[model samples]
Each structure stands twice: as structure tokens, then as C-alpha cells.
Target: MDSQSRVFAAILTESGREYTGNENPQRLKVQAVDRQILNNRVQEVQVTGTAEDCCPADRVSVRVSVGHSKDSVNEVTNSVSRRLEYILQVVRQHGASEKDTSVRRFLHREADKYHMDAEVLITFSDFEKMERVRSVLLEKLAKSVCVGTPQFYHSAECLSLMRRRACVSAVENAQQKACEVSQLLGQTLGHPFLVREEETREWKNEDEEDGGRCQNATRLPHPSQIPTITVSSQVSVSFTFRDISKKKPQ
Candidate 1:
């Protein structure tokens, strides 16, 4: 091989290293540049930061029941069926779809008297729409109707969005902390070089449901304060800093 072709070439190692050999060796080998490059990429200040917030539940479920009594099972059942149909129509008018509603029927007979009931489970994405539907059901069904308190919870999409927002806040917190630390160390803050999410946590009010206790309810459930969802995030960020004092004199 030509001596000129033996020119030094760069190589990588687990840890950056420097090689200083003969002034002009016949075969020149280049090394240690990677360590310098890696050092340039590595950040100087490391910080662990966290952020948390609570988001109100936006999804709701309302269960309604209609019941009737008559001399025959079929008669009472037909009566409840008519009321349920009316309730469904009212729900559709308020923007609910068939896919969002579930219907179930019940029957009992005793000494020529028949009792029948039908319940509808309606899922609503908007509270205003639910309020409208509830009003119509109460006005139309009157004595035979009962409306339950809306069950509040978070949807998958809502949870995902909240989690992302929490992570972003956590990163911001880490940067802020790093900036303060760099200032205390007499350094100028630079852009973050690396970020590692150490943990993500979720918390809920002990008095409220956390998407685990779900039940098919009937009759009116007394209203209480709405539940809340909280998501928190922890992140470790490596922030770059510059030594302002090290700048070359003018």
C-alpha cells in the first residue's frame, strides 16, 4: 500500500480516547476524535423533574327506566315498550345514536297483575346534550320514569391526550430546574441534549371512581360532586451548559 494511502482515519470506541504516537509514524492511525465528539454531544447538568394536574371527566353515562302495570303481561310490556320507544326518539333528537344506546327489559307477574319495565343506557360525549335528553324524558314519561345521575369517566383518547400534556409539562419543569442549577453553578444554559422519562404516575380522589367500578344502574342515583382524573410525569433531562468565563478575551 502507498504511504499516502496510510493516512490516519477516525474510529470509535466504548469510551472516548486520545492516541499520541510517533511524530510521523510510517503508518498513521487516527483515534480519540470520537471521545471528543461524544463529549460535545453529552450534556453537563442533569435534573429530575416532575409535573401533575387534574382534568375533569368529559364523558358521561345516563341510565333511564320506564315501568308499567296492567292486567296482562303483554299489555304491561307493550306499555313499557311504547314509553321506551318515545325515550329513544327523544334521545336521538338530542344527538344520540342507536350505537350509543343499550336496551334491556324485565317482567314479573302476580295474580292477574303484570309488571314490566325497560331500561335504556345512553352514553353521551356532551353534557349539554344529556341535559336536554333528560328533560325530555322527564316531561314525557312523567310518573313512570326515573333518571339516574350521569356516570362520569375519562375516555381512552382523553387519557392519552392528558398523558402527553403531562409529559410536556414535566420536560418544561426539568428545563426550568436545569436553568436554575446552571445559574447557581455560574454557567449559561444551553439546549437540552438528552431526556429520559423515569416514571409516570396516576392519582385519583379516594372518594371518586377511577374507571374501575362501573355498573349497570337503574332508578335515580343521587347526584354528587363530579369525579376527577389526575396524571403526573417524572423525567430526567441532561441539559447542556456553557462556561461564560471561559470565553476568549477580546
Candidate 2:
């Protein structure tokens, strides 16, 4: 071939590889790399939030005890039995079933005189009923019956509800924070891409430990004063970023 013809042929051969099928695999590889880079550019925001709340007790228990001393064993036994029976009858009449009541009795000699002591523990779901039973026993029996103060506590259902409330509150706080941050960044907040409960804690109100001036304790928070349980939760949430222009009209 002539020199000019040879130069033109060399140029054609050098540029031909780009259109040939042999370069297809390399082109596909470059496109795959570009897709990976685009995936890495996807925007997301992560935030953490925490919340705490208190739950009131739902059940109460009361204890009643009676004791008597006499010169003879028969006298002490009869006296104690009569009072014990009366107490049990009063408890049963106040909406308390056999399953809700427990009884214990003791008979012994102290200083040559026979002595007897009996106790009844009653569980009440209705606070009104518990108060009524306590009042009646103290009124009719006078100093002969000793009625203890009410002890309040939370039931399983109450505890479950409290836990759910705390967790949901934490999640809501996180979502609110994410929305505000997204607005500041000129982006719209999108649906949550990931949600996780990072931690949870629970404790009883301890006013006594803090010199009786804690926030949850204006007064002494004993079992008789409707003690409260505090529950706290922390959550981490990740949300995808959306375009502000694409946000729905409000």
C-alpha cells in the first residue's frame, strides 16, 4: 500500500475496537461501577431520641391482725377464734373471694398465761371496697383489730401499657427531630428506613433516697400513698432523604 493509504488504514484499525463486540465486557464493567457509586450517594439521616414516663399502681393489699390473752387455753382459743371468724366474714362480704385472702394463726403461753394471735391478708381490686372493709373492721372491733395501711402496686397489664407508651414516645421524638433537621438542610423528611430500640430502663419512685424532695415525690411515696413506677426508653431511627420539590402540598 502507498504511505498515505497505510496511515489511513492504521487510524481506522485503532478506532475500530470501540465499536467491536470485544469491548462490551469492559463497557458493562464501567457501567456497574457507576451504578455502585450512585447507590453510595443515596442520602440518609440517623437520629436518637429518649423519653420517660410514670405509671400509677393498680392494685392494693391490706393486713389485719387480732390477739387475745386469757388465763386458760380454752378461753384464749375461743376469744381469738371469734374475732378471726368475724374478720374473715367482713373480708368475704367486701367483694373479696377465698383466692384473694390468706390467714395465719398462732397459739402459745407467755408468762404462764395463754395467748393467741391471728392475721388475715386480703387483696382488693376495688379501692372503694378496700377502704370500706378497713373502716368497718376498725369501727366495730375498736382497739381489738389492727388494720394496716394499704399497699399499692402495678398489675402486669399496667406495666405492659407503660412500656409501650414510653417506647412509642421515644420513636415520636426521634421522628420529630429528623423532620426538623431535614427542613434545616433544605430537604424533605421521608419514611423511616430503619427503627431500633436501643435501650430501656425502669425504677420505682425514690423520694426518700433523695431527701424527700424529688420531682416525682412531692410527699412521701410509700406503698400506701399510691407509689409510681418510672419507665424510660431510647430509640435510634434512620430516614431516607426526599427532595423538597417532591414533597406533597400541605
Candidate 3:
């Protein structure tokens, strides 16, 4: 293959949410403040992937969130840090026994004066183990921290995997497409002498809001009313055309 051997590539993205129980007392409170927190957590868990496997580089981002009073930033920060530390300890205890399990990245944010968010990224050899890690974190967070449940999202990885797989499929599809185009133009398709791929990333806020009579909202009977969260990813892809030649009259 020459340096200019052209081939076509494309990207595909996908998203999924890891579900768990929400047992926070504040989540079930009839007050609007508590209701907002519940809604936020539910929306966070409901995120869905745009493509199936691969994600674009630029679209790789995560959102972390927590609910607290305006003056509680310091307290919230310390609480979140301790919670994460405990999570890391859990990974060290259980994950160390296995391979390809470690912390990839961790982030913290204050969406406003009243809310604190922590985004934690953990990597494992496979999805099954990743699920286990999520479960472990949820348990630890519930017991160790007074904050809402901690959620995990494979935002970029979801899209990245989709893109990688799509690229492979796109090559096959592009080859067939090129062949059809060549035949239609009364020409023969030459071997791909050049191939290139282009991609872009976009950020979007997936927000969910409910407007209804507060008095009518159903109330959870228990404090352990498992919180719901949604995680999602977005991206775009383009494939370029390449190499053309004419066939002799036959």
C-alpha cells in the first residue's frame, strides 16, 4: 500500500445507563428542592448512547453532580473526596485481585451554589467486571456518604467503540459503494490508492423536566427508593472518497 492508498472510514456511537436503587430520603420528600434532586438523578441515569461502539475524540466528556446547600461547598467537597477515596480503596481491595482494573479519571463540579457533582471513571477488562465495579461503588457510596447515589457513565467509550466498529463496516460498505459508482460511470474501480477519515465532536445537555401539580406526585414509602440515572454520548462522522480509473472498452 502506498502512502496515498485511499480507504473510507466512518464512526458510530452508542449509550446505555447503569440502573440502581434510589433510597435517599430527600429524593422522596414532597418539597420542590428534594424533587429537583430526584429528577436530576433520574435524568442522569437515563442517558443513552448515540452510536453502538465508538465515540469521537472531541465528544468525550463526563458530568458529575451532587445536591447540597449553597454554603456547603467545603463540606460537600470533603464529603465527595472521602467518598471517592473509599471507592478507590474498594477497587484496590477487589480490583487488585483482577487484571485491567484501575481508575482512569475522577472529576468534581459544583453545578450551582446548592449542588455538588463528582464524576468517577474506572476501567476493567470487560463489561461484566465494569458492572461489578459500579455496583461496588454504589454500595460503598450509599454507606459511606450522605449524598445521592454515585452514577457511572461510559460516555466516550460508548461512542469510541461504535466508531471503531463502524469504520470497519464503513470500509466494506464504501468499497461496495465505490464499485457501484464506478460501474455506473462506465469505469472500473481501481484498488484503493488512498483512504482517509474525518470526525467532529459536539456537546449537548440532555435535560429532563417535569411540570405538574406538586400535590399529586406519588411519594415513596421508604428512604431506600433507589435513584434513577441516565448516561448518554453524541458524535458525528464523515468518510472521504478515493482512487478512480476508467476500464478499457470490453
Candidate 4:
């Protein structure tokens, strides 16, 4: 359906008083000369707009663990430590940075048998390399190795940047719509009185198809196939509904 722009009386107030109208009055905020004048003024316009941005999901967190069983606690711990070190070295050779790998070892005693488990958290941008690492570790460690599922996510810096861009886009949309309507009515657009966010959302799209290469036995989803991170924002903006052309010189 086609949309229509409207003109409303500009009322700037912060009395926290409840107002009754078809729209939410709390969102109608603006700098005013006087609250009494704002309430009495009859020129105002309301505009609501929405915008979104999609960023590629390049970062992924992969958790890998190895469990070893031996007759003595020392033997299990030593074996697990050696295997963990080797696994880390393999990952590093495949482009995983040392700063992104965190290792933790757990030892437990069950009767005469001792069990030791070593786990590592690896964060990187390459999904294929991660899968290769997982496969090679499983090949060497056999039954003692376990490759946990990789959880996909984006970096903080990327998401923050997208959100800010989306906000600007939403405001621009509102401004364009407002300006068009005001011109048609012979009124010049003024400074925005209020811009309040009505909705902010973040989500990942997982419906993209990558030509039968989405996932494999390593439990790593194809980065290109998975949905990218998306940010959306909706805002209700209020602008002064008046004319700059008819102003008198001071």
C-alpha cells in the first residue's frame, strides 16, 4: 500500500504528563521555547521509519576436547598434556593464532582407573581449517578424541559498526519522507524535534545454501552458506511542521 505523510502541531514538553492521542505522545519530544506555547501550538508532524544492515559472519569459536584413561593419575595427566600440546600445535600450523587458543585440563579418579580430559577454545575466521584440524586429530587420537560443535558468531567491533550505520539509515528515511510531505503542503521542513527508537533487533540468517557444502562430519557449518548477522532498527521521528520561507528577518 502507498504511504501518506502527515503534518502535526509541534509540541515540546517534558512534564511527564500523560497525553491522549492516536499516536504515543511520549515520543513527541523537541526543544521548545515554552511548554505552554508547545501545548498550544497546532503544527506538528510524525514519521516512523525502519532500516537494516547485514554483516558477514567471519568469526567462529571451536571447542575441542581430548579424554585419556590410564591406570595412574600421573600417567593420564602426562598423556593428556602431551596430546593437547600436539593438537594446539596442529591448529597453530593451520593458521590459528596462539592468542586465540585457551587450554584447560581436568583430572579425576574412579577407583583404580584415572581419567584426564584436556579442552581448548579456539577462535578463528577460517572454517575449513577448523574442520581439517578436527579430522586430523580424530585420526590420530582415535576413540580418545572428541571434537565439540563449533558455535558461529561475529566480532563485537563489526556488530557495533553495523548498528550505528543502521540507525543513521533509519533517520535518513524518516527525514526524506517528512521533507516530501511538508513540501507538498507548502511547508518547509525544520530540525527534527524527536527521534525515538521503537525497535532494535539482531539475528543470524541460517537459510543460505552453499551448493551441497553446508556441513560435513566435522560439525562445522560452511561460513558462506550460513546466514550473515543482521541488525535492524525502527524509529519514530518528530519534526517541526512549519515553513522557513515565511520567516521574517530579526
Which candidate leads in lDDT?
A: 4
Candidate 3: stretches off by over 4 Å: 1-93, 96-144, 155-160, 201-250
Per-residue lDDT value at 50 in model 1: 79
lDDT (tens digit, per residue) of candidate 1 on 111-146? 779988778999998877887787777666666787
Q: What shift in Å separates residue 13 of candidate 1 from its native position after superposition?
A: 27
Candidate 4 stretches with Cα past 4 Å from truth are 1-42, 205-216, 222-229, 245-250
Top model number, TM-score: 4
TM-scores of all predicted structures: 0.67, 0.67, 0.31, 0.70
lDDT of candidate 4 over 20-66, digit per residue (tens): 35567567664445545534555657888788888877677767777
C-alpha lDDT of all candidate models, in order: 0.70, 0.71, 0.37, 0.72
Superposed model 2: Cα runs more than 4 Å off: 1-39, 71-75, 186-193, 203-225, 242-250
> For residues 93-204, what per-residue lDDT tens digits would candidate 3 score against the true structure?
6544333333333334545554454444444434344445545554555433322122223445555565566444445555555565445534445555444443323332
Checking candidate 1 for backbone clashes, the offending pairs are 16-35
**Candidate 2, clashing residue pairs?**
none
Error of 4 at 155 (Å): 3.1
Q: Tens digits of per-residue lDDT for model 2 on 5-95?
A: 0000000123222232334333432222233333345566778888887877778777788899999999999999999899999888887
Count of clashes in candidate 1: 1
